[model samples]
Target: MSPRPDTAARQQPSPSSPPSDRVRRFTRAERWVHRTTAALMGVCVATAACLYLPEFAELVGRRDLVVRLHEWAGLLLPLPLLAGLASRALRADLGRLNRFGPHDGTWLREALRGRRGPAGKFNAGQKIYASWLAGATLVMLGTGLVMWFTHLTPLMWRTSATFVHDWLALTLGVVLAGHIGMALRDPESRTGLRTGTVDRAWAEREHELWRP
Candidate 1:
């Protein structure tokens, strides 16, 4: 028979452990960059919708006003994104998001089944959205420049730019809504993004695979 459990083992208290504290994840500069980009994107989307939707445009009229707002927003959009890209930590995080690994495939499978799997720092869906946003932003910037500086492109090219710009804006707006919804689904996640630090339990539960 197995040895009887020791009364001393049960009676003696376990070794004292230090209390866990939440650590700062994103630096102030990094959080600033994220906030700046999000704000600019929000304004750009709102104004673009006003310009595109006939009912909405009628209320906000003057195509020139919407066009000017979009141009300025386009100019400001790259600043924060570029700053984030320059940071070593942010760049590394972006690289991790770009990578498609076996774990990502497993996560995707579980996601399709309406089940949650162990997610790393960013899951496959988030990675795809990030990539799409980065690409779409670049495309929008280039196209916007062509439209803003009409002298740079022929009339046909300008017309094409209009089509491309409008469609991409609508698509990105939809994608951004989904991304924001996912982030807001978990209160901890929204708090983390807003405050740049999350509870240790939240980190371990949602991003255990993220090793710094």
Candidate 2:
């Protein structure tokens, strides 16, 4: 049977025209939660630097003010995420972050080779980071609280908490730097995060498993 020209033409996209389909990647609530968490995280990092580095301490001047800011920022680190739990979609996404799938293993291997494979809304690397950060945030908060309430914690525990908090802060700073570096290099990811939407072709290519 001979196919009609019109039928064949409609079956495939035109080569000359760019795909116009766009998909929503992040909801308004999701964007707001991410931005709020980011701002608080930045405050925690900056104040920690001010307290730990002599140069930053001199620049910041008021040690008391910096200490208070650091304590509050670290304490509130999980608040945005907690608030986001109201959204069913956000809660579902959190579950996805906590689980590892077969495709995620393949994605990790491809990622090492500087290639991308099919992934859901969040890839293996992102899931790993999110999972780690969730636990790390709790650890930091617990240690920070122990240090803050010295009256409640024994001298030995306080000393141990202080050491843990200091070292964890440094580790988090390095991981965050790498996260920011990757974000800066990936324009489509950046655009999707900012605009809450991504080009259909890009989404289909990079996140074929993602469904919205």
Per-residue accuracy of model 2 over 1-212 as CA lDDT, tens digit each: 97899998898876644446877787777887899999999999999999999999998799999999999998888899889989887878788888889999999999999898768988999999998888889999999999999999899999999899999999999999999999998899988778788898888888889886
What's the TM-score of every candidate structure? 0.83, 0.88
Per-residue lDDT for 200 in model 2? 89
- Tell me which residue pairs clash in candidate 2: none
Runs of candidate 1 exceeding 4 Å displacement: 1-23
Candidate 2, superposed: residue stretches over 4 Å from native: 1-20
> Candidate 1, residues 1-212: lDDT per residue as tens digits?
65557965776555542125564556656788888999999889888888878998998888887878877988899898687776887877767878888888888898899986667888888888878888999999989888889997899999999899988988898888888887778887777677777777777766677653
lDDT of 2 at 132: 84
Clashes of 2: 0
Specify the highest-lDDT model's number.
2
